[model samples]
Every structure is written in C-alpha cells, then in structure tokens.
Target: MNRAINCHVGCRCSHLTIEVSHGSYRNFTQRFVKAVVNTYKDLIEWPKNEHRVAEIKNGFMYGEGRNAWGLPAVGALDGKNFVIESETVHAEDWRDCKGNFSMKLMAVCDDKSKFTYISAGNSGRSHDAAAFNLSEIATVAMENHGEYFPLDGYILADSAYPLSHYIIVPYPASEVLGRSGGASAKKKFNKIHSSTRKAVERAFGILVSGRRFVSKHIYIKDTGDIVGIIIAYYILHNLCIEMNDPVLEEDNDETSNVDVARPDSFIQSVNSTAYQNGRIRRHSINPYFPSQQ
Candidate 1:
C-alpha cells in the first residue's frame, strides 16, 4: 500500500483515475479505512449491565461535590461539528448554528472520557436536542423507560438539551444570568452543571486531537460514508483505551444497558407514572428547577 501511494505521488495524472494500480491512492485509502471501520464498528457497544450503570451512577455521585454537580449521572452529553468539503444536494441543511458548513456528531461519554452512546449523521442545521431525540439511544430509553435508567440516575447535558426525568440540564438563562441579587440560589447549581458537563468537551478534545482524519476537513460526499468514517474513529478510540495502544501518548491514555416488558396499554400507563415520579424526584432535589412544560 505504501509503495502504491509512493507511485501515485511520483506520477502526475491530469485526472486521478481509480483504474490505476490497485486504484488511485485516495480511492484505496478510503476503501481500506472504511473496510477496517465497518469490520470493527461493533466494538463501540453501549454497556447494558445494570451493575455497570450502578458503578457509573456511584462514580458521579461521589464526584459531585468536586466536579459532578450533585446529579446522579451515568454520562455527560454533548455534540461536535465536523466540516464536510463535498457539496451535497441539500447544501443548506449542512449549515450549523455557528453559520459553518458541517455535520453534527452528538455523543454521550462517561466520567473517564469514554463514549457510552453516539449518534451521528445529522445535518449541521439540526439542533443538538433534535438530533438527540432521533438517536437510537433515545428511542431505546423511551421504550424501556424505568427499566433502562438506574435508580435515581440520569444523564447530564447542557442547557441545549431539554430536561426530563432521565436527563438533567442546566438552569435556564433567566435564572443563571439573573441580576446581582436575583435568583442567586441557581448560581451554585449552574456552576456544578457546567463543571460536570465539561467532561464531554474533554472527550471531544481527546477524540479529534488523537484522530487526524476527524481533525481534518472530511471530503466524503456520501452521508453513509461519513457516518462509517466517524464510527470507525470511535471504535478505534475505544479499542486503544482497552488495549492501551501506545501510538497515543501517556496523557492521552485516552483512547479513549437494560430491558423491560409489559402489556401495550399497561406499559404506556407505567411509563407515564414513572415519568411523573421522576419529575417529583427532580423537584425534590431542586424546587427551583424549571419544569419541562
């Protein structure tokens, strides 16, 4: 492969052709990368053990006083934008809130900076909350309801996400950005929320910093191809952590759930009751917290 790439670099073709020896270097590189990614994408599985969920919940609770924000959380949710160089049929949909042309990669990572859930391929224009709602993880969480979440445990996210029983978000801007003497109570909560959510940023930093391809502008035109590449990056990211791959630096040692069953109507009723209970529980923790309504 190295020899073929070297040959391609030596030869000057007016137009790069896939018919070259083993195809052009760019073509071969894309196929080889995607092939490896597809083969190992299964490695990026979400932990389903209740015990592991408990461990994560416990870890967050113990760390709350210092960094976790007092929320019994199993993961921190956030999103990253990736630039796509190829023009698409719906080019306008690729524009993000920041006015940049890109795609969104939404993910949930644990305290250790390992991703527990990821949903990518959303157009850049899609809001973080909207992208999350459409993710498979969200669908699973909704379907399983009480069975999925650990007791009193929820995921922590920024204000960009809607607050629910299973997910906690920061106080609203009105409370967090209040006048000098107004609603000072929410300040502490917001501080904790921001502090805990910083883990997601660190995770993205480690991911993009470690993977050169993700750091560079992605030129793939096909949405599926882009998703595969991102997933491939994630698989390698986790494997490196598991095997302690040395290509990553010491500091970068990086590298970086559930079931339920019930009758249709009965399950829906149970889910509603669970949601109400969760709301009450949240209120008990913070009476000033805003209601989802």
Candidate 2:
C-alpha cells in the first residue's frame, strides 16, 4: 500500500516499476506473492465515506441529483477495461472480438463520486450484468456489522445491472436497454423518471477520461497480477476522484495520438443483426437530451 501511495505521489518508487516490468513476478516467486498480497491486503485501510465525501463535494456537484443522506453523493458504477499483459498460448481467443481482452472491472462510487465499493476478478469475456451479480455492495452489507450506508439510501444503475428492490433503475427498460414494453404507457412513465438518473455515467466518464483510471499507453500480456493492478488503479482512480485532483485529460479528438484500444483487430463494421439492434438500442438513450441521462 505504501508503494501504491508513493507511486501515485510521484515518488517513482521501485514497486511500481517492478510491478509492470517483465519477469518481476518471477523474481518474487509465487509463494512470496501470496504472502505479500495477504500482508498488503490486510494492512490496507480504505478511507471512510465521510472523509471522501467532504473532499469530493469541494470540487463538483451532484449535477442532477439531490443531497440524499445530506451528502452531495454522485452515484457511481462503471464497466472499465483492466488491461493485461499478453497471454501466451490462448491469447487469440481471449482477445475481444474487437480487440484484446482486458479484464472488465466494475465499481460503485457514492454521491461524492467516491468509491464505496468496487467489484473485481472478472474475465473480459463476462458481460456487465454477470459481474454485477457478484457485486460487493450486495453481499457485504449482510456480512459486515452495522449498516454501511444510510437505511434510506439507494442507488441508480444502468439496465446492465439487475433491477433490485434496493437500488432504482433510472431508465425504464425500453429507454435504457431498448427493450420496449408490451404496450403499456406505464413503461414510458418509468422511462421518463429514469432519464434523470444518469449522474453515474457522468461520474464514470470523468474517471475514464482521465489517465488515472485508463493509462494512455496500455499493452498487455494478461499477467495474473494485472487484475489486481487494474482494480487497484480503479481504487486509486477514485481516490484521485475524491481528491478532485487536476489530471491531464485525453483529447478525444486526438485519440489517435494515444494508444488505441488493444484489440487484435478493430471492429470494422456493424454486422447486419448488430446494425439493426444497435440503432434500436441507441434510439432508446435520450433522443431528447444527448447530455442528459
């Protein structure tokens, strides 16, 4: 953890270099890794929610959300890339059909846009909902003592997450997922209500837009360690988010200059079925407000 903190603050520590360097894992050997990981994980102290909330509120507003629980919380949950070092043999198949198959890391940030929970350890082949099913937030509440979040607290998520009684789905099925109702106006009303629930996307977007969550230069070979690194980066990213640190953002217009997503190949064109389905899916997302939820 000290290594992570030091590396983040420009200490240029050896841990960061060794972490990504070739054959570094071999240096520690597998047994050493397990001991080190257990030691570091045990020592890790994720900051409290109140401290994070205070820092985040100083920089940004909930945008469209209310001060629920008296915190300017920004709802967060994201599907992000977890770059790997290349796999040796089966790398080709693990590669995303569009490109490389980085592990997918999902997380839930709070109203201040700080990470309250992060769920890791998913293969890139998994869909967003598959990961959501194994969410830490859902299971952790039952195991840990005391109520972690306010009893009146709730969350909003995209359709990719399972609709639960605790967290609300902001967009109705059709508007969010392009799955229309079976001839009910009630569905449309639900859709209207859900449109405002998009603060999560914006929160996620800001994280990814900055290099802290996504390194501009990524090349992976699927190291077993990369998964933790990816997750650690997400946790670190949210720390930066909570800090509201000024980071150099990528210019999407100049995305060409940065490392392109490492798919073995680009998605050349929309398949006939995809083209049809994609249009329908996109049509459902806020035709009225491109920037709105």
Candidate 3:
C-alpha cells in the first residue's frame, strides 16, 4: 500500500511500474487516498486546546524573528486552485478567473508550513472571501471565537479575505496608497503582514511542487475523489514535515508562483459588528507601526 501511494504521488507514469492493470492502479490510488484521508483527518485540524494554540502562536511569533509583527497569529490563511479537467455538471462554476477548470482548496498553515486546517472542493469561481466565509472554520470562529482561537489568537490572511476579529487582513490598497498622514504606517503594516502571511502560500507551493500528482491537471471525474486526493496530499504534507522530509524544489517553472487571484473589488460592510470590531482591532495595531520618513 505504501509503495503504491509513494509511486503514485511521486511519479507521473506510476501505472507503468506498478505491475497492476491501469484501471486497477487507478482504483488502488483512489482507495488509498480515501483511506489515508479518513484515517489521518485529525492531523489537519485546528488547535484543540489553549496550550496548543499558544504553541502555534509562539511558533509564528518567534519562528521568523522575535515577535515578527507583535501579533499573536496561530497560522496563515489562503486559497489554492487545483486545475482539473472539465466537469459535466456545473462546469461553468469550475472555471476560474484564469479561464481554467479548477477547484479551490482553502487552507491554513502554521509558520512551519504545515497545514492545520483545510476546506476543499469549492468551485474555482468562488472568491477567497466567499469561500472562507462559507468554511466550517469561519462558522466555528464566529460562533465561539474563544474555543479554537483562545488567548486572543488569530490567523493572518491577505487582503482577499474578510477582516474579522480572528482573521487579520492587510489594509486596503486605497488606505495604504492614500495621501493621509497614516498612509505610510498602513503601508508598513501591509508589508509586514504580507511577509508573515506568506507561510500559507509556501505551504501550497510545497504541496504542488513536492508531489507530481498534485502539479498536473487532475483528470479525475468525481469531485469527491478529487477532494479526497487533495486532502490526502495535505495529510501527507504534514506527515512529511513531521518526518523531516526535504521539500522538493519546483522543477516546473509554472508552478513556482502560488499566489491566489485577488478580486477586483472587495466591499467590507461597515454595518456588520464583526467588520466594525475588525476595523477597531486593526486601528489599535496600526499606530504601533512606525511610519517611514
């Protein structure tokens, strides 16, 4: 089983060497992915307790440097689009901004680039903010912010995400580019936020570049199987980190860039309590950033 998994994930023409027929090889791969994902699903969950949360926060705070942003961030959040063959049902929904048929995998990862949580199988046409808002983590966080994100812990995200008390996003381009007095400080804050939030992007990069199966356009017909394969990759990604496996360099130049597509317009509702509180929270931290001369 292990050999089959390794061969399938690591090689493009894995069926050729597996000794099994092509159909059998495909079935085995699917079954293996499903089993692995089901068995190790806990490996990709949010922090269970306050102590675990603190540990993740400490890692993010001191991993790159001493309290890199002076914020208690447990992880970084982002979305990654996996290219797929055209689907028969809802095919247009699977088309992304780049005109490719794909599915989006929304994920969060710690400073060490290990995936802590993931919500897969969303259509690629969905925006990052919309996908995140509909995610289980978002619902949980909104219902009980203290349970999963205790001690004021939050995750860093890009401007493509909605700013919430538990999800810190960068200042909008308008705010940072304005001629106002605090513009420089906001810009500085954005720069630091981007640097810290890139861990999620790196995690996606590692997943795609590390596995041959992930980098190619997945030809699977069933969306559930595609989701299972994605989850399996994330599970194995964390396992590799635990086992201290060296991350493979990107052999394909096209896969080197892993940034998600940003929406043309992001409207934050000021009437929402979460949005107001998020703004206040960001304001409280913005002044701490020293403005450039």
Candidate 4:
C-alpha cells in the first residue's frame, strides 16, 4: 500500500526509479495492481444501472448549467494516448498521430472526474472515431438507443464523432458561418460543450499525475501486459474517486495534447449506412433545448 501511495504521490521521485531499477519493486507493483483490480471489478462498470446513470446525469446538470443542447448529459467522452517504449510485434500498429509509440484509451467520465467507462487497448494508430465505433459503448448505445436517453439525454463528444441522438457534438463553425445569429448560437453551444467536456481532461490529468507507471513512458514489452496495467489504473482511479481521495494537482501546462479526431471519410458519405443511421437516430430524440426552455 505504501509503495502504491508513494507512486501516486511522486511518480518521478528518485526512490521509485531506484526501486524499479532493482527489479523486485517492478514485479511487486505489477502483482499488487493486478490483484487489486481483479478483486474490485464490480467498481468499474459501464453505462451503469438506470438509477446510477440518472444520478450521474443530475450531477452534470448541477455542475454545468442545464444548457439546452446538453442538459441531460451524463458523461463526457475523450481519448488519451499513453506512450510506451518497449518493442512489440505490432509496433507500427501502436504508432500514433504524434509519431510516438502509444496505446489509445477512450474514456467517458461524469462531472466528478471519475471514469464511468474506459475502453483501452486500441492501437494508437486508429483514429478516435474509429476506435469509438468499435467500442462496447457504441454497441450498447446503439442497442439501447431509446432507453439510454428517452428524453434527449446524450453523452458529450467532440466533432470527430458523427452527431447522433445518443451523442452530441458542437456545430461545425463552417456550417453556421455568414448566417445572422448562427455564429452566436454556435459560440454559445461550444462554450457549454467545452466547459462540460473539461471534466474528462481533468480526469486524464489526475490519472497521469497519480500513476507513476503511466506518468513516464511505460517500459513494457507485451501489449497485453501494458493494457492490463492500464485497466488496473482505471479501476484504481475510480476507486479513488469513490473514496473521495484528494487529487494531486497536475502541472496543467505540461499535459499531453489531445489528438484531433479525424473524421472517417467512409462514414461521412451521405449514402453510407453510418451517416444515414446517425441522421435517423438524431431525429428520433426530442430536440435539445437550453435549460431555460
């Protein structure tokens, strides 16, 4: 426990480096993390029960004013890239947009900055939209589209995602440019979206800051092991939030840049199944309105 706490408190400390260099501590941390994560699987679940989802949505509405476009938003989704240094069979697969070897972790968090859903192990080379399309959350959202948000509630996502009833993205500036009042409404919506979405960034910051193993480039060889460790961290992260653990302040200026989600051309075609489904799904939901509405 002390070692894990120490790792969280000061991941870059010389003491940890020395212990890790000696071999035993590294093995110990791996076993310890795995044991704890496996033991507490119940704490980390996605698209929680209806009652829990409602409670989480209420928290978002309370913290971020009930804006019409995102009033019933229960979670914010974002992807984070973790650098890895060891060579693997699929090294090229893990190469990211930033030209680094990495693994992409797509996560959705509530207002409290706790990860409600995290899908890890996607090749960093995969675009955020592509990764999300293949994620379990997307499958669940589609399967229970009506039940997920009967009253127009949706998860907040960036523009990389196709806008649908289950997910909301800010209006593209170009779509509203040169029209009177269009720009103002677009600006207002973006502000609300950005503010609400910042919670995910904060959650990423807290995770990176607290996990020494992740704060530095992970020197593991097996992709599976690397992924397992990351899953453990996500579980631990949520546990911290549940316990009301004090968050260590991160150096905001040093945070890694969020990769721009590239729009998948195939999915964007109007005739494509994805685009058509998205349009149809969006129409099925009640129109979103600002809190005042």
Predicted structure with the largest TM-score when compared to the true one = 3
Give the runs in model 1 whose Cα sits over 4 Å from its true position: 1-39, 63-70, 177-182, 245-281, 286-293
lDDT of 3: 0.74
Candidate 4 regions exceeding 4 Å error are 1-23, 64-70, 146-152, 253-267, 270-293
Tens-digit lDDT string for candidate 4 (1-293): 43443343443454465544424545776787789777987676655467777877777766644453344577888887888864646578778888988888899888788887888888888888889889976787667766655444578887777665567666555533564554555556566666667778888888877766686577666677778788888889888888988876764743535434334453466226656555455334323323223
lDDT of each: 0.63, 0.45, 0.74, 0.68
Q: For residues 35-114, what per-residue lDDT tens digits would candidate 3 score against the true structure? A: 89788877887875888888887776567644455445888988888888889977897999999999998999987888
Runs of candidate 3 with Cα error greater than 4 angstroms are 1-19, 64-70, 178-181, 250-266, 287-293
- State the lDDT at 138 in candidate 2: 55
Q: What's the residue-level lDDT of 61 in candidate 2?
A: 38
* TM-score of each model, paired residue for residue: 0.72, 0.52, 0.84, 0.78
Instruction: Give the Cα error of residue 126 in candidate 4, in Å.
Output: 1.1
Positional deviation of residue 268's Cα in model 2 after best superposition, in angstroms: 34
Per-residue lDDT tens digits for candidate 1, residues 1-293, read 33333343433341344445434555766787688766766666555568878777666556644633345577888887887754557687788776777888988877666778788888888877678878875778756756666564677776565556777665455544555533554566556656666666767777777765666466556677677678777777877766866533323322210111122343224346654554455455562345421
Error of 3 at 242 (Å): 1.0
By lDDT, the better pick of 3 and 4 is: 3
